[model samples]
Target: MPIAPKHLKFDDGSVTIIGVDCATQSSKVGLALGSMSKGLLTIDKAMKVGKSGSIANVVSSWIRENSTTKTLIAMDSPLGWPIKLGEELIGHTAGSSLSTEAHQMFRRRTDFFIKEQANKQSLDVGADRIARTAHAALRLIDEIKEQVGMSIPLAWNSELRHPISVIEVYPAVTLKSCRLLSATSYKKESNGAREQIVDGLSEFMTLPEADKQSIIDDDDILDAVACVLAGSHFINNESVGPATTEDSALAEKEGWIWARMPR
Candidate 1:
């Protein structure tokens, strides 16, 4: 028998969505503003955060500007490290043998789950350059919380009505789920792949012609828009979450990547 669909009960009329394609350097970080109202999603703006030296300032300014609307910040970066890596490193010496295997220590449960469901594996935060991006993401969250004067928690439920909430998103998995271009393909020199991706995305959200061209010109901008679509899947209760209690427990510490199931 087929399984029944599960959905989060979100009843709000409208909400602002910000998709952040985070990077270690502020110049490479991309930000996109979007909105969902009465079941329609629209992309309002997209741009690089610029060489402002601080991504928090740009994001905080946007938040302050849209203070009246509930906002969801979907970031394209890991928010936490592997739970096993943290647990196994406690009180360890330089030459001590680790209890957990290297693969398990480097990957979180959510990483494995995404691979199993979407066939798209996220980078290992414990042993990759992406670790720096992950650190930046966490620090950015803390800085934003301090600047905004609000508790910006990692949202687990779609119906979370907090004034400001954040969630980790993987644009690659989202693109795969939507049958668009692969993440690496669109970042190449040619803009053909990106144009195709924008065309595919237009079926779901309203994208201005100028913004669509901007997204095609920059991979970071495209990923930021994809992040918004992933967040939309979460809000519409189409994205997968932790299925087991142990998965949930690990996700609480290691963070979860919000994306739709494989097509």
Candidate 2:
């Protein structure tokens, strides 16, 4: 069967609500513009590459394919980096994540931790998937900001819902944020099929500007799209928890961090 179908109208929207996610092994893109729901998101594709150049390509392709969504891309990474890096890339870190470091936000949200668990079984911290995923998003955030001048959430404010406009999400440091983005989905072992998503995000982040030659993963974009949809969900629903308070995270059935949200 096919990994990603052509397209399905999920929700009806004046603006095409879209979300994007990045993972270690694969990438996911979601679209929530016009259908039955507020926003419709779905996985676009997945790929296998190891750096920024390849990930950007994946994103560009997806955007081109779904360019009609009046596209507003929601990404699941830090979008910006440290001062030194941010200034160079014209990006800054999202400030809200500090409330919860691993707050679940998008594919990267659960993805980072899921792979953290898998890291023990796959790439180990020395080559851990979570860090790698975060790094991949961070790198992409830098590149996208440099070229597109986007990504990076502002301070959290309830009035605006997420304190950021268009780009919505808590900073990566917030407690179990209610998102589904993470770079942990892909793992690098044996046939090296896991890291495919991560590599795809890297390529998409760079895009036509950098032009890196890495494999692509549509799943990364889909996951990022998930994060975006969730962000819009939080804004419209206003139930993502106090835009100013910390979230409640719970461990998995196995006694590990399974999921969390603002309480």
Candidate 3:
């Protein structure tokens, strides 16, 4: 079944938004925090994860500092494991019943949904390119949940109306929707590819050229910008790809990746 995107409602320009590109290694995570005021969006904070830095500390500190502001965090990570996979991991599945069909049966609805909408697919948390990152992300999620409380998923935020919210993000999918670059390109070590991405992003938004060039070699920073934009998109009611009816149960386990935001 195809997953439909969720529409979120927010008070006019009142929330501080944050975006994080979660990485298994702390040094690679990227963060962008900002807000929209009078219809003009501005990013006031940007950081590339350093070897000595901790993702938990950065997030916690940001929340603490912004205590008075309503907040929305858009993170690039899998917050939960697939339900069937979770059962198998916890020994809840019959040994004889741990079949491929069973795994397929519980595949995350959002993954298929994103593929259909963005022509991009997310890695399965159980076993995929992002598996390790997903594990690391879930740990951060637990810590943040304790500090900030359970976050409202994008799909549910419209009705629930929480002061703080979090939604899964995919930069490649987001970039594709924005038409800045193809999902498969611009994520490479080569200078040519990096320059292409940097140039593409520059065209979409007003960025400090010098600062933008400094992070051009690192796609992580570009993704951080993408995540931050996704957060802004959510706050602006421009985000798409939320959990559908069939996805509620799976989204509770495997988090939904909000796709289809224009720049």
The residue-level lDDT of candidate 2 at 13 comes to 45
| Model 2 C-alpha lDDT per residue in residues 201-254, reported as the tens digit of each score | 332232222222222223333344335434544435432322211121221110
lDDT of 1 by residue, 1-263 (tens): 11111322343687788999989898899888888888899988888867866778777877776665678999999898897898899878999898999879999888999889887778999997899999888898899888877778889988765778999999988988888965557888898889889989999899977777789899999999999998899989998999999989988999999889877
Residue 138 miss distance in model 3 (angstroms)? 2.2
Q: In model 1, where is the ten-residue run with the lowest total lDDT?
A: 1-10
> Clash pairs of candidate 1?
none
Model 3: residue 248 alpha-carbon error in angstroms:
2.7
Q: Give the candidate number with the greatest TM-score.
A: 1
Clash counts per candidate, in order, are: 0, 86, 2
> Model 1 compared with the native: what TM-score?
0.92
In lDDT terms, which candidate is top?
Answer: 1
TM-score versus the correct structure, for each prediction: 0.92, 0.36, 0.79
Residue 221, model 1: lDDT of 94
Candidate 2 similarity to native, TM-score: 0.36
Query: What's model 2's lDDT at 91?
Result: 40
Preferred candidate (TM-score higher): 1 or 2: 1
Taken over the whole model, the C-alpha lDDT of each candidate is 0.85, 0.34, 0.67
